[model samples]
Target chain A: MEANSSPLHRGPLIAAGILLGAGLGGFVDGIVLHQILQWHNMLSGKLPPNNLIDAKVNMYWDGVFHAAVWVMTALGLRLLWAVGHRRDVPWSGRTFFGSLLIGWGLFNVIEGIIDHEILGLHHVYEYTIRHLPADLAFLGFGLLLLLAGWALVRAGRTDTTPAAASH
Target chain B: MLKLLATLALLLAATTAQACAVCRPRVEAAIHAPDYTDTLLLLLLPVALLVGGVLLLFFSPTLFSWKPTPPRSTVAP
Candidate 1:
């Protein structure tokens, strides 16, 4: 490559990774927390799932949530494809992975704030009368993700070139 | 693609419709009993914000900066 080669943009890859990461993270939430653990439903706070009918209703909303994340994942894949075709997009795993962490953490933070706290839609663990502890823990985890992701993303800046070519 | 999506849609519809033969209507009724619009908005809020933030970053990652993006190549000193 020439010395003055066009600068490889980091935005696209970051975006792609974030979307992909968040989408997959959302699936984990739906599958593990919502389904497997049965911690809480999409609207468990609003309508407690103490009975069969109510539980199914929550399940239905969970499906909808999954569908939205599915769309996000698809969009991320499309963005990745587009970035691959471009000669000016860096292919740094650090950048991408970092972005993914950011996405997941972002999901947790935003969802934690809006749904869990503000809307009172649900808590991390719904079995107890006091839901603050679990909810705070979830937010704490998200902050940790953000910090880790920031480090990786900063490190990725050193990786330049289309495919990490030697200077 | 169209056919696959159609089939999946049909399957999803079918499964949701028949989860419980006896109380399917009751479940559906209960779910839809509330103001449908409000429920949907609330449910979609998180995903929407998440998607929006990512898109903003994808378009402009400047919000989070590094030591400036390294050049694609450099002439070795």
Candidate 2:
């Protein structure tokens, strides 16, 4: 029998998964890029590196960008939890984790494209660009992420819809 | 848990130190300096709230409603 699902069960869980994936991934980008590698700053976060303008302007915007990402991450997780259904929430464990992977991949792709290519802000690695390989590789990583997210999303949808699966 | 806590503490320390030098200029134009993280952090709360509110409005009713249909009562003659 095809059981009906509610928004509480579907929407928030999915949204939260997506948001958490994005936020955590973004944070990792910040932590890794800024601290571990020392290629950027915490203020820079995931935004484009400051080379187009003076250092001061770059510093201001970089900090703003980092704060923005941090806020988004925190809120995103809360929203995910708040929006998910109590009874029908996807806790098959497998599906939840799979979605997380997909979501993380999706975040990487979207951020990579918008921040790196479209904005001409920065690359995945610093001081090693100006070549086709680096640019193409960056874009490729994003594409892969989107595809992975799409697959996981589809999987989650299918798992939830048992009746649909039968047909 | 300890690792996570320690990492978070480190991150907080780093963020604070990094932000101190640059957050003022972004908040005030008159300062003639760069400081955006502080204002950005200040703004983060409202934005996160708004996003959370939207998510709640969208999904709370469907996801959180725990009312169960009551069993029909049987009458004995």
Candidate 3:
């Protein structure tokens, strides 16, 4: 293909988008569920943080989770930097933001399925007897985010202008 | 750097030496716990999927190779 005709290298953009989204999404889970809501910890179901030692163990696991997400965010930043100068990559805000939502949605769905359902780890709101509804609702919201993100990314496909060139 | 290393070594030694009877079993239980590998995998599944999906999306342009529209001619009518 001719140089001008070559399609954009969307790999970097997509990578950056998803990683950033997942990282931020992970933060939301850590903060809202683990902290504010006091619903659960990383290992609450398996080893409820009832006593000091068990609590310490849960805290340790939570730290591990946070560390993993921090690394993901860093990786996303690196990918964004790598694609910053490339002319072929469209620097559309919609694509990036959309990817973020998708990433977050993906996190919620995956976490909801594996942790809440499959592993029986913890529910979104653990205080009530009927926790399944809350968990399902969380997954539903994640689905909504995925749809919105997908739409935004599709919209971004028409934006072919180089970001730097426009500035 | 040397002081930091010494301090770290001391901390490690102190922690090992100071393991109380009550703490030892809990620590041992945590370390020797069965089925934790499965738990770890479950936790990691979503992260792996997100990373995989993103990579797939990134490389999709190459796999599909959708043709770009030709640039408009600069000449005016």
First chain TM-score for all predictions: 0.93, 0.66, 0.89
Q: Compared with the true structure, what per-residue lDDT tens digits does model 2 show for residues B1-77?
A: 99999999988877464563565554345224344445444324433543464466345556422322222342223
- lDDT by residue (tens digit), candidate 1, A1-167: 54234545788888888889888888888888998999868889987889999899889888888899999999999888777776566678899899889888888898899999999988888889999999999899988998898899999977765543421
What lDDT does each candidate get?
0.82, 0.51, 0.75
Give candidate 2 regions above 4 Å deviation: A1-9, A40-60, A126-132, A158-167, B1-77
lDDT by residue for model 2 over A104-155, one digit each (tens)? 5655555555555554455555555453465567557656765776666556
Candidate 2 has an lDDT of: 0.51
Per-residue alpha-carbon lDDT of candidate 3 for residues A1-167, written as tens digits (9 for 90 to 100): 24347676555676788789989998988898777876667777777666767766676677667778887788778777766776777777888898889888888888889888888776677656787898999899999999999999888877666544545
By DockQ, the best candidate is 3
- Across all models, the iRMS values in order are 3.2, 7.6, 2.7
- The residue-by-residue lDDT of candidate 1 on B1-77, one tens digit each, is 99999999988887554548888889889878758779888889988987787788767846443333334454345
Q: What value does DockQ give for candidate 3?
A: 0.30
Error of 1 at B51 (Å): 1.2
Which run of 10 residues does model 1 chain A get worst, by summed lDDT? Answer: A158-167
TM-score of each: 0.83, 0.54, 0.78
